[model samples]
Target: MPAFVGAIKINDISGSAVVNIGDVFHIEPRSQTKTFAGAGSFNTGNYLRVKNGYSVTHTVDADNVDNSNIGNT
Candidate 1:
């Protein structure tokens, strides 16, 4: 018995006070956007890149969205 509730609270509702009144379904609200420019490599591993230097560097951190990016909208 709930549609769109907004301010008109009643007391004596007890423990947790959550009156959602049902029918507020906004599922699949997941957003993950990534955009990069100049310096290639997004979500990487083993990228030991050194430009104009007499040095040694090592980098590795790989897990570029293995699986399951969430479904069902």
Candidate 2:
């Protein structure tokens, strides 16, 4: 299964509920972190962590992530 970052969620074409990250489980593929500190360009981070059992933190590299705008494409 693919991982998610931030509050970005993935829904099937049927629009069914998938899963939500609650900072609990510390799921995988959390490197796709996109934070909006300001308004002007998107701030992309290469590292992301999910707290496992609210204790250990798991981190992974984004591996050349792209955050360019696509405007409706």
Candidate 3:
């Protein structure tokens, strides 16, 4: 099994803002195309990654935001 990192949870009823470092996120692909054989399509995977560092600030709208899980080692 793969080692799990951390998780975070955010509860925002309203507001638009930017994301800074130390922010955790849950990213999922809406759709994917198979470019090679044996490669599956429309597969959904939930992966978590922390913003250890970033060159610039990341902005997002209300539609592109979600809660995260943290403190999981």
TM-score of each prediction:
0.24, 0.17, 0.18
Clashing pairs in 1: 2-21
Root-mean-square deviation of Cα positions for candidate 3 versus the true structure, in angstroms:
19.0
Ranking by TM-score: 1, 3, 2
- State residue 37's C-alpha deviation in candidate 1, in Å: 22
Q: Model 2 TM-score?
A: 0.17
lDDT of 3 by residue, 1-73 (tens): 3445477566663333343345446544333332332223335678844344334433434563254434422
Index of the highest-lDDT prediction: 1
* Number of the candidate with higher TM-score, 1 or 3: 1
**lDDT score of model 3?**
0.42
Q: Residue 18 error for model 3, in Å?
A: 15
lDDT of 2 at 16: 36
* Cα lDDT of model 2 by residue, 1-73, tens digit: 5555665656563333235555455433422444433332344576745333434333444666565433422
lDDT of 1 by residue, 1-73 (tens): 5576566857676553445555865534234444433333334567666354343434443767734448732
Worst 10 residues of 3 by lDDT: 32-41
* CA lDDT, every model vs. true structure: 0.50, 0.44, 0.42
Model 1, runs deviating above 4 Å: 8-22, 33-60, 66-73
Off by over 4 Å in 2: 1-54, 66-68
